[model samples]
Target: MDTDRLPGCYRHPDRDTGIRCARCERPICPECMISASVGFQCPECVRDGSGTGHAPAANVPRTVAGGVVPADPHLVTKILVGINAAVFLLGLVAPAVVVRLELLGRYVEYFGGPVEGVSTGQYYRLLSSVFLHVEWWHIGGNMLALWVIGGPLEAALGRVRYLAVYVLSGLGGSALVYLLTAPNTPTLGASGAIFGLLGATVVLVRRLRYEMRPVITMVVLMLVLTFVPFGGSLSVSWQAHIGGLVTGLLVGLGMVGPAAGRTRALVQWGTCAAAFLLAAAVVLVRTAELT
Candidate 1:
């Protein structure tokens, strides 16, 4: 080999790069070129060689690969927070307009509400209720919990799986509410799904055998928030919390099961589809009874 023309292989001196790394402009042999975002990275760079860890830049929105310590790759936290904020804003504005316009549509019922009575065709509430909140504090608390857990969970579980857990958790909570609540009572909030995130976290920690401090602390705080009465009457829904937890348990078990290696990739997608179908059936049946 010519000594002056960089003795090492174009990709790696030890190895030869018939190809080059798309990112760092280094020669990479076929063996070293591992697939990356743009193209491929060298073995050294790919194998802890590159110092640029995937952390989101401050104030800049970007996605990282997996849940690392510095910044979570899963952007589910940001998206969920944005959604809650948007819905809360709408809740505030729509209430005013709904009052003035006398639109029955202004009221968002939870869990489809009463199977029969004057109230019928409000079936959409089963799903829409997840986005609705009775007050600012309600949304704020739930969103905060979501921010704490969702990112880490999403980072640990990929984005698709994270979303699967979220949607299924919400559905599970709603189903429990429907079976348990009096038909006349109305309930709503992301608490159900957020609870599922917490449950999922607990299970993840146990599976991964990481320090239980952070997750345990969060769980304790949540439990306190659920039961303790504050400012007189507490607007807490423990049922939804329990339901979310149950959903998370099922999701976590499926994710960590022996089949995880072979089937985890497609698990979330299937779960999401089944959950949607179930929600639809509930709505249709309730609507029919109401009508």
Candidate 2:
């Protein structure tokens, strides 16, 4: 406590003149001093504490103008798009690739047709369908939609939750097809999941009391067009769209409203898990019928 009688610096005992490290309060010479906002500190104290003076600006989590901590980059979305692109490229290399990867409801033992006509092991098609595209243009359209809708949604939901929304939504779409559509028909692309996210966005925007009329109008228009039956060549599965959207709305019930602290996450994840399980059960029951 004596200003003038403080002991000499531990490291440089001969040079101390009573100035001390603000953090450790150890005597320090000018040589060991590093100026902080509050007072001078020693190098060891800097290393043991903030070390903030030399930290990069980019290391901080930045907040937006509205006092919102900007969410991390949508890495999951990008990874998804990349995977789709890779699969598309592989299909390009081998033309027969489509026949192997596209979703079909029937079970197959090998390169041949279904074994005894029952849906046994081909449940993977429900998932594989989300990544397959019949044409380069098909992938182009789906990927564009993904980029537009996915980034913001992933940012809002975070990586794991966003992935859950996307994958489960896709499976929900295929579940409808499995129950309602013919077993031989092959359906492919990401439209179902995209529609699901769009539907969830509408619900979330409304729940948050944001201006959502525009989003609602857009989704309605798309759904209407999906069923227009223009020349019957588009072969767009309105079933998938409806299924995904309904699932998205169901999942959003737990996610979009006022923050429930840990309860919010628990409910949101519970809703997601229930939706997935229900879809799986539907597929299982239908498969039993086929077998």
Candidate 3:
């Protein structure tokens, strides 16, 4: 080995291209290069950069491995927020449009409803309802909560895992509403996912034995506002809140627990999967009982 010779490609030692990574300045070949704003980066740099808060230049998007999908930190959270915002904008354009998007308890009512009634074939409401909000304040509150929790949790759990937790939480909440709420009542919101994030955060803190009183306090306050009537005729859906919170807790314990090592990882994901299956079972059992 020549002491002064610049290193060859880390991956392809046989081929000494002498190309340096833009971020880490490690020797790389064209095959190992990931294009960046300033210069080509090595695979490790690309992978590490995507997980960090640092981003590529405004004009250039960073991609991993094959240069196909752009690698982004907290990308899922941003997309989720954008979807909710776009749907809300559409609602502003037309009231009827928004009504159709909301989740009605009647569709789950296999038994009966008024023939030729408002209950339509919106089987997708179970998932779609998570994105629809009628009021600016409603969307605003939920989005704010998402913004608060999304970044860190998404970064920690990775995009797909975070999305799984969020979607399942919302779906669980909707199922709970179908089972518990009046058939004629309509409901929709991302509170269930938001609550799930909160629960995940709590789990993360609890496992680390970190101070989590604020989380507990916030959960308590929200519950109080949910169940206790406000301003005389104010109608709040405590059932959904409770459902979301419980689902989030189970998710937190399962997906974001403090346990360590390979065994912990297996248990964590298994727990998350079971939580989802439990929610699905609830829907099936409730539907069967009603039918």
Candidate 4:
């Protein structure tokens, strides 16, 4: 062996290293090195000897939607709940924050205050409104639904895809509200995102070949409740619910549907992008009319 010269790492050819993998004797860099009881080993060697009692050909565990299975499957759901809770607390402390963040097309908040809303270029309200809640019952119901529906969805879809479904669903709801609802009406809640999770749940359940009765009943019940007028006051935005549901269904199809191999990720993200673009187009048309 050459004493002065060192070979490049097998994984990272650009780097020079003197250390060899304990199991395979292949030169490795610090990045590829995994500490073992005897000495450093390459990533391949470590993975092969992971002690899973399976052959090297065994597949790595992955979520249903192809995401790497995380240690804490519900971590994203918990974080989302925390964020909603914190935002709710902040809204309680400063009532004005709610007014600012809530979804409004275009309206004067006060007698002489400047107009505020998506029409006035406050586009962030589309997403921000999803987290703003004024009533305790409202936040409580949303948070509970989030925990129940979001946990399983998060576990199946993994964090990034789950979060994407959530945010896109919320935006889809906001866009519909902005387009159809009266400009002066104030709308806010996580219901749209929750509904999206519901839609995704339906798709996931179907994909997994689970029993269909429960999901069907849940969907029908939610739709009926959403559409039924309460005391002749249509305070709830059915438009948002419909929008989120449709978007979630489409994205979920892309997620767990038949697309395969290298194109799977492309299809999944493409569906998300398409949903976002459709929502943006709606916003643009609505903005033109409102302005």
Question: Which candidate wins on lDDT?
Answer: 4
Please list the residue runs of candidate 4 whose C-alpha ends up more than 4 Å from where it truly belongs after superposition: 1-59, 231-234
List of clashing residue pairs for candidate 4 = none
- Distance from true position, residue 262, model 4, in Å? 1.1
Off by over 4 Å in 1: 1-72, 96-121, 266-291
Rank ordering of all candidates by lDDT, starting from the highest: 4, 2, 3, 1
- Collision pairs in model 3: none
Best by TM-score: 4
Q: Mind giving the per-residue lDDT tens digits that candidate 3 earns over 1-291?
A: 677554678898874554577677878754565656445677777666753346533223222211233356578999999999999998888766655667775543322533211124345777788899888788998898898877766655666667777887887787788778766678888887788787777775565344467778977887788878878856666667777778877877776443334465577578778887887777776666555
C-alpha RMSD by candidate, in order: 12.2, 15.7, 12.2, 13.9
lDDT of each: 0.60, 0.70, 0.69, 0.83
Model 2 ranges off by over 4 Å? 1-72, 107-118
TM-score of structure candidate 1? 0.62
lDDT of 1: 0.60
Candidate 2's displacement at residue 149, Å, is 1.2
lDDT of 4 by residue, 92-155 (tens): 8988888889999997655458558999899999999999888888899889999998998887
In candidate 2, how many Å is residue 280 off? 0.9
Q: Give per-residue CA lDDT, model 2, range 1-291, as digits (tens).
A: 666554677788765345576678887653455545444567676655564555543223211100112345568888999999988888888856766677667744546554422285756778887888868778998898888888867665556766777888898988887888777777788888888888777765664344466788879788887888767567898878888888877776655542424355577777888999989998888787776
Give the clash count for model 4.
0
Candidate 2: worst-modelled 10 consecutive residues by lDDT = 59-68
